[model samples]
Target chain A: MSILEILSYIGTFILLINTIIYSISFSFKKEAYSFFCVYLLIMLIITLLTTYYNSQKVNNLFLSHYYFLSQFILLSLFYKYVFENKKNKLLINTTLILIIYFLVLQYAMDTTLFQIFNLTEVVVTSLPLIIYSIIFFYQNLNAKVKFIYINIGVFMYLLCSMLLFASGNLMIELDPLINKIVWIVNASLYIVFQILIFIEWRKNYYRKIPKSS
Target chain B: MEKELLQEDSQIIVIILIAIMILLLMAVALVVFFFFSRKKIIATELEKANLAISYQKELLYSTIETQEEERKRIAQDLHDAISAKLNVVSLSTHVLIDGTLDKEEQAQTLQHILSVTTHTLESSRRLAHNLLPPILENFGLQATVEELCDEFMSSKKVFVSYDINYEDSLSKANELHIFRIIQELLNNAVRHGAAEQITLNIQEYDKKLQILFTDNGRGFDIRSIDKKKGIGLKNIESRVDILNGALSYSSELGKGTTFTINITKT
Candidate 1:
């Protein structure tokens, strides 16, 4: 296989291993572990799709469904982890229904369901994140390094996703160099945010033990 | 398409500005809430502490008053009964020794003086015992408790048993306090409980000591044991508290009464 394929597979394997560890750690009720698992699942799916697309398997509808569905699941899970709520059931169900409705639409579009995919992609990529911005707004005067990290990361992801979507998958016309840069930067921010989420979880978990001893 | 992108960018900027405004308002409100509530909480806690301190002061004052009143009563009793009798005996003895009289009359007078002297001595001994038992001061908790039990048993027909796991070598003050507590409890058992069989046990474990007393008697309603009326029990409780110890009692009518005290020593 090519070097890029080897790197994608290796990344997928690493993410899969992280997913397993996180799934096991979730048994202990660690939010970080669950968040880690969700992120790893997203990354693995993204890498798998990229690998398939490179291998000339772009026409497969199964790959298209797998890609959007994984993103939907990953986004919802990440949203729930950061902001705990019983009321989120409504939000989650609505988002899932929207994804399914669009997944069926992708079949008719015949161009690999890119537009309907964008609908889920844009919202999942932005709205909940902007909802998180509410916290920063409320905490206007407070110093929050984590909030800073999250806001920057979300902004990066939003800019990159928007650029990618606007180009209509025509990388050469939209500047393929910019697409590569956006991809690398967004992925790096995602990895950093994942690490930060894990660190926050560990801090809270350790806090649960009594300090008196 | 360009217009739509520009509109979206403007909307995003507006949303960010709105979010910043909202969070800023929330933070200010939170600080205000904390500032007011902290003072309220502190004020409430201070009020509680003051109230408790006032109640404790009232209790201590009443205890001192009760002790003084008891001392006054004992002093009056001694002067009225024992002292008067002693004066009479002294006059009679003086008359017998100084005046001439028949041998038989003199002998009867001497017998009368001896009986009066004996009764006066008994009354004086009882008075001293009420103040502080001599046996407890001389021999310690075990000997004093045993002597008290024997004395009460002989008079009241109450069977008493004393058991010790380890001999206590405590300070004089501690020994005195423990003795007083035991004495009051025993008196209550005999007077109110009408107890027939009483058992007292002293045991030492680790760095603490325990005193357990059980009586098979016609116990009273434990629920109705008012501190105002049950002065003896209250005194025992206060002593336990002062020692930083624990006291527990359980009793049921016609069943029995059990009192346990656990004291940790330095």
Candidate 2:
């Protein structure tokens, strides 16, 4: 496999390990943890299916479609759970409306089922996530250490990924070499997001245990 | 195909550049927001700390002032009531011991000594009572305040009149604090206000005691009363605080002063 392919596999592995560690650290009953676990689980499934499809030399655009749909649904629920204490009705309602709009666009738009990339869908889905991350960061500017790290991680990941994916389809059509480099960078950022989440989980775990002398 | 690919490449570059610019703007905005927010938080905390320290200093100064005032008053009382009367008794004894008078004259001298000694004992008792009134300990706050007002009236200090309607008695410590507050207010009215017809009203409602002290005196401007100079008012304020009470003072030049205190029952 190419170095880029290896890096993508490493990103998937990091995400899977992060989810496992988080699950061990916190109970699944909490809304925030439960929603996050669902999100990570979906991503892991998609990653595994994509790897399988690539080895089999079969198309995986259907899985990509599922990936976008699940992300829109699960990430919205995740943030809503995170901000449950804030009682922000506007954020919750906006997220719901955005999800509905994304679904309608995906069904109504004339797009190929086996298409290699869908830049419009990616941008439409990512823009709201970026806005939500920024809002979370602003609201929790003075929050605990773990929360600050989480907000930064979310904000940076969504922001950089949005930029990369917004120009990704054009890069592929223009130059395959540059497209590969952008994908590599995107994979690295995904790994960074996983590491940040792992750190936040570790902090929360230690916070629950009583310190010994 | 080559031309279209070149155009797409340029489009991608433009989009990437725009995204980078937006990201830099957001970073700058976030840094400025955090910087100002931290500065504001620090300033607020510092202001709160300063206010607490100033309050503590005021309390300490008032305590020291009350102590000094009490000591001076005690010294003056002893000199005027006990020392002078004792001097008279001593001189009368000297005359009786001269041994030059007839039996009737000596008997008259003995009677004179008895009168002087009795008067000296009464003066000593009055001085001790002024220090800590026994009436406050035995009778409740109402009776003690009534006795205080009657004494001021008999002395013709300022024609003091009081009406007390307190139903429940307070603890000894609380009553003593209330008594001292009333005494300080009356003293201020008599010495500073310098008018007649002082009225005191004490009532209890909903487990809270309220006292209204008003005087038809030549009142001075409340703003002109410096807290540092008026130790008596500070002492009264401290006593009111000890009772978990709130005190309000209102006065206008030549319009008479009024003091209102509301205390919660323990």
Candidate 3:
């Protein structure tokens, strides 16, 4: 396999392993992390199905819609729990509603767009998550900031990848070599994101759960 | 349709590249902003904690210094009041034992010994009383304060007008703090202010106690009252701190001084 394909496979496998680990560790507490674990489970399943459809030489671009929408909804709820802001909530809800309405309108007007990466979905979904992470940091300037490592991971990954994802239709029309390079950069950033999550778990969430639990 | 889409593709890619650069720069700027602001906040917190620790250390050092000074004063009193007089009585007894005097001389020596011994005994009793007054232990604060006012009027040559309506009985330890506060203020008025007339009023209402003390002395400026130079003031401040009480004082340079204190019944 080429390095690009190999990197993609590695990211998928790591996501699977991390989801399993988090589910098991967080099952006992059933707190904020329980919702996070559910997000992880959904993400892992979607990644596997997308990889499988790609190997079968079939169209799987439609999966990106589910990926983006589920991610936006679950992670929005997660952040809303972490930091309560009515304004942030309103922004997320309004954006999600607007994007869904626009996408449905586009689908009714034309059906051919489903065969390619929808640029509107990529831009609108990732933008709020980016803004939310920044808001989290801004609100906790003088405090002992919590969930910082995870936030940094999300902020970095989403910010750099948003452009690559948004430009998907344009990228397909360009040199295949450049497209592969973009995927390689994305896979590497995903690895960095996972490493940050691991560090957060080790530093803040490591505990000797009892056997009875 | 295909030619038009192809024509727009390269233009869109160029725009995407520029946009990506802008986003990456924003990300870098944000991280730097959070890092520096967090560092500044944590530094200020550490500074505040250090300031509190140093203040506590200074109060503790002054309290120990006051205790040592009190011990030294009591030791000097023992030497001058009791020790010197005993030396004279010892010398007189030795002269009597030598058997070189006639009956009238022996009688005279005995009388001298009797008077000296009595004076020395009284000095020792007064010294012990100064350490912990029996009047305070048995009669409680009110009776003790009344006697203290009479003693200050007669012995220290200060006219003290004392009025009190306090009714709540406190723990002995707590009462001792109140008594010492009164004693220290009275001593400062007599010795430092050279006050001839002092007025003290202690009133209790709804379990809240207030003490108003004023003296017609050559008062120093209250704004210039330095705790370091006056251990007595530090002692009073620390006592009030222990009792969770509030103390305030005002003075005119040559007119007089007034002190007001308030504390809970507890």
Candidate 4:
């Protein structure tokens, strides 16, 4: 394998370890973090499937649809636990259900579109999560913040990656150089995101719930 | 046409890079903002906790100092009032036992001894009363305050009018603190103000008790009252602190002094 391939796979490697560790933590102490644990596990599964399809020389771009769809759904629920405002939670949950239903309907109508990059789908699914992190930031000003690392990571990585993914089809139509540059940047950002997830688990969720005496 | 297409591709790349840079800057700015804000908040919290701790220490020191001062005052009163008078009586009794005088002389000596003994009895009773009034224990705060007012009235110099509208709902410790505060205020009025008319009003309403004490004495400058000299006022402040009460006072030169104390249910 070349250096670039190894670099890209490092993020995937960390993703695997984080999935196992989080699942273990969840079994010990079921908490709001359980939603996030499920999110990592889902991402790891998608990563394995995408790699498998790529090895067989099959079109794996279609999996991006499932990837974005599952990401929005799981993250919406994860932050649902973090948000204290009842109105914000209701809005997130209600919109989440409606958007997923519509996306499924759209896919049912046009199955061929899965192989193509959908900017509208990316924007619709990812934009609300960015807004949720911003709301979390505003809520915790000059106060003790909950899940600090996770909130920061979600806000930063999702924002840049969403922009990258939106421009993915345009880059692919051009030379391979543009695609390489975008994927390298995307891979580097993913490493940072996984590291942030690792820090959050080690710092907060690693300890077992002290049994009541 | 080919050149225009190339230019458009470069423009798109430029736009993407610029967009990524802006988003990256915003994320960094937010994280930095939270970081510095937390540092400032922790520093502020530490400062507040330190101030609270020092304030508590000052109050504790003042309580100990007031206790020492009371013990010294009681010691002086015993030596001057009871001990000195007993010494004089002891010499007179020894003279009577010597049998060195004739009938008239012996009678004069016995008469002198009788007057000194009677005088010592009254002094000791007054000293004991000053230590802790038995009336304060037997009766409640209302009747004891009334008796306290009558004692000041019998002095023939100060006319103290007490209006006590109370239900006696305070703990014994709180009542004692209140009683001491009143005693200190009255002493300050009589000794320092030299006032003839002293008005005291005590009333209780809905978990709150208010005491208004007024004296038409030669009032001093309120600003001139310092912690170093006005130990009586300081002692009153300490008792009020112990009771978790509020005390306010108004006094002007050539006018008078008024002290208002309000205590809540603790």
- Measured by lDDT, the strongest candidate is 4
Q: How accurate is candidate 3 locally (lDDT)?
A: 0.82
lDDT per residue, candidate 4, A140-196, as tens digits?
765776578888999999999999999989987865654566677778888999999
Arranged by lDDT with the best first, the candidates are 4, 3, 2, 1
Model 3: which residue pairs collide?
A: none
Native contact fraction, candidates in order: 0.00, 0.17, 0.53, 0.39
Clashing pairs in 2: none
List the candidate numbers ranked by TM-score, top first.
Answer: 4, 3, 2, 1
lDDT-wise, the better of 2 and 3 is 3
lDDT tens readout by residue for model 4, B136-173 = 78887898788888888899999998899987799877
Q: Cα miss at A162, model 2 (Å)?
A: 3.5
The prediction achieving the highest TM-score against the true structure is 4
Off by over 4 Å in 1: A1-213, B1-16, B90-107, B226-229
lDDT at residue B50 of model 3 (Cα atoms): 96
TM-score of each: 0.50, 0.63, 0.72, 0.78
DockQ of 1: 0.02
Tens-digit lDDT string for candidate 1 (B213-245): 999888767778753445567678888887778
Question: Clashing residue pairs in candidate 1, if any?
Answer: A137-B23, A138-B23
lDDT (10s digit) by residue, model 3, range B1-266: 86675557546655666676687678778888898998899899989999999978887888889889889999899999988999999898899999999999999999999998899899999899888889888888888888889889887588999998765367889888988999999999999999999999988788788989999999887657763448788888888888889999988988988999998875
Better of 2 and 4 by DockQ: 4
Per-residue lDDT of model 2, residues A35-125, tens digit only:
7778888889899999899789987666766776687677777777777456564666676787678667666776562375567667667
lDDT of 2: 0.76
Instruction: Tell the DockQ for candidate 4.
Output: 0.39
